[model samples]
Target: MLDKIYVIDTNVLLQDPKAIYSFQHNEVIIPAVVLEEVDSKKRYMDEVGRNARHVSKLIDSMRGKGKLHEGVALENGGMLRVELNHRSFQYLQDKFVEKTNDNRIIAVALNLLLEEQTKENGRQVILVSKDALVRVKADALGIPAEDFLSDRVVEFNQIYTGYQERFVSSEVLTGFYKNNGIPIETLQCGILYPNQYVILKDTLRKSVSAVGKVDRSRSFLKKCAFDNEHVWGITARNVQQRMALDLLLRRDISLVTMVGKAGTGKTLLAMAAGLMQTEDLNNYKKLLIARPIVPVGKDIGYLPGEKDEKLKPWMQPIYDNLEYLFNVKKSAELDKILAGISSIQVEALTYIRGRSLPEQYIVIDEAQNLTKHEVKTILTRVGEGSKIVMLGDPKQIDHPYLDEYNNGLTYVVEKFKDQQVSGHVKLEKGERSQLAQLAADIL
Candidate 1:
């Protein structure tokens, strides 16, 4: 089939660099303005900057194969080129002179489409982006525009976090309680995925039931393994903790979403599981962790100092959990523990764009702070042999446009509820401390 020409947007590359590859055999067109925009972001020490650098490097390497301005063949059998079109609207430069960047990008797309239309057997030119307003403007201009569907989620309501409910016979319920165990093989009839918590209830009584999970070994609740030793000296104190452990340890449920109030141990449990899986079990090659840096109000502007220094405040929560898990007092001690484990990486979400990660355990904390588009971008980065756990409290969202029911975390839960590969748990009990729990409940 003849490849379609796709005009790549800066935001799309900023979200995922390999986005160019997502088009499969399609020809990707990167506007010069997009590269210029990416260049401006390349110096910052965040996910976006990192992505810009990555895309730059990718384009540079491709130059060895052929001219980047002309086009270069990708390993995936596709062409990538930088489009240099400054001709857009004649009045755009004067009317929206201040909005130079956006106008230039739109101009590139419009020019590409117009150029394509003049061809004898012209191919369609689609402007692919993660920016919504850009799409709106493209539509107004009669250009074919679309949100980068590679990161576009299945649906706002189709993402699942892998928890389910099932009705079992009274005998099964009685057996589960009496023996405190049930074989996985016997439960497979209703079990969805490993680590999925099942609310097994008696069909007749409806109330007689228990909640249990299928273990990593695909065995029933009776034979599942639970890491009793506290991760970094922190033990699972409650049923919710146990549930968290189950979710973390299970191999089949690659996507786990946990929602809870402040003291619910959501982040702690996630970190512990990440540590255990990445450090102890070596189930995955690395533990890649990140969270959106959505401030409560107006922007804080650019941060100063080295990458670690700038990220410290934003990553304090992750460090605190690590400190507790490693049973260390000093920051240096925790740093050493982290250093000893090369696979563990705590990064800002800003840098994760435009990278393809495989064989790693990823954790996105405070996910409620991310927009639907951002969440979709992060999830699509999951390659192979990877598990991504998104933990957050929807009610405590920091994103201005998002709310309890509309946030990305909730969106994932509602969307992927029926999928066999995902799982979700609403951590209810607050185990932080009496005061903290009280504050969480009353406040």
Candidate 2:
């Protein structure tokens, strides 16, 4: 077999450092300009920055084996080398030569191609990049270029986070009421995961009824299980109270993604579930929750105080849910719950890079703000025995270059629909209040 050489672009490493080893036994080359690009992004205090630091640590760890400029032996029996060819582009100067980083990376590929042309071994050198324009430019230069395929594109409509609603016959509806509930065997035929919401319909009357999630044991358990149930001395209204209990008490579906407008109990339900599962049931080790700090078009820098204070505004929704779940009237009381429970953690998505999490229940709220690439990076970090739930409303995306159809939350739902390990639900009805539902529908 002929040895294949893969020239990796900087974006690929920043997206995933382990991408170097994903090519199997093939030789991986890192253009020197790519390293410079990676160095520039290392100072960022975001997810990208953490990934940059991780890649640097990975390369630094390889120094004991050999010099990186030459080549380092990967665990998968592949070679990774940092190419130091500082070539210039006179032809590109006529089109675009402002000493841009993109041009510098392209120049390295051109140099490698020219060097390969004279070799008697005649190995194939492919330019692997995550940037679409760079690959187009490489193709124009008569060089082989392709997108990083290890991450693989997911279909737009197949991903399943495990929530669905189906219409059933009046007879089936009667059976649910007569039997006190439907049978597990009958429900299993249609397929269901824990924490999935289903709407039972009366086909004859054309009316519908909502059903809370059920356990794997087919027990009709409430979803969110709150201990005290009063927040700031205000108890949840009858329906809100029931919905909250439904989310917290259920144990079948490990991952639950809830999407709804404000006041719709999305975050509240998730937090309630985390509290019951972690503090009460002790089913999981800890409750690890995170959300992207990217707020609309503006960055986190515009906020005051340190990273934690600046993150507070974005994390307030999480705290609100926590405060309500703990039934704390005072701010200090809420702090005590956080202080007492070492198992419950609220963190930013920025710090999640390169960490392998296990035996924890993770909830990522407002996931619609994340890009497809960013979501993939977060999901790949899940370790064994961990169930990660992502909740967000696609209609309320705040990230640039992301829309309802292309955001990470929707992307996950469409890509994992067939897989039994994941499930998704789109909360259509806003259970907050009559006014809130009206507002969600009209305004």
For each candidate in turn, give its C-alpha RMSD to the true structure in angstroms.
Answer: 8.7, 7.7
TM-score of 2: 0.60
Q: In model 2, what is the error at residue 49, expressed in angstroms?
A: 3.6
lDDT of 2 by residue, 222-294 (tens): 2323354543334445444444444434454444455556666666666666666777778789899899876
- Give me candidate 1's TM-score against the actual structure: 0.61
User: What would you estimate as the lDDT of candidate 1?
Assistant: 0.77
Cα lDDT tens digits, model 1, 99-182, are 567777778777777777898888888887677887887787887898765554444544443455668888888888887778
**Winning candidate number (TM-score):** 1
Best-fitting candidate, measured by lDDT?
A: 1
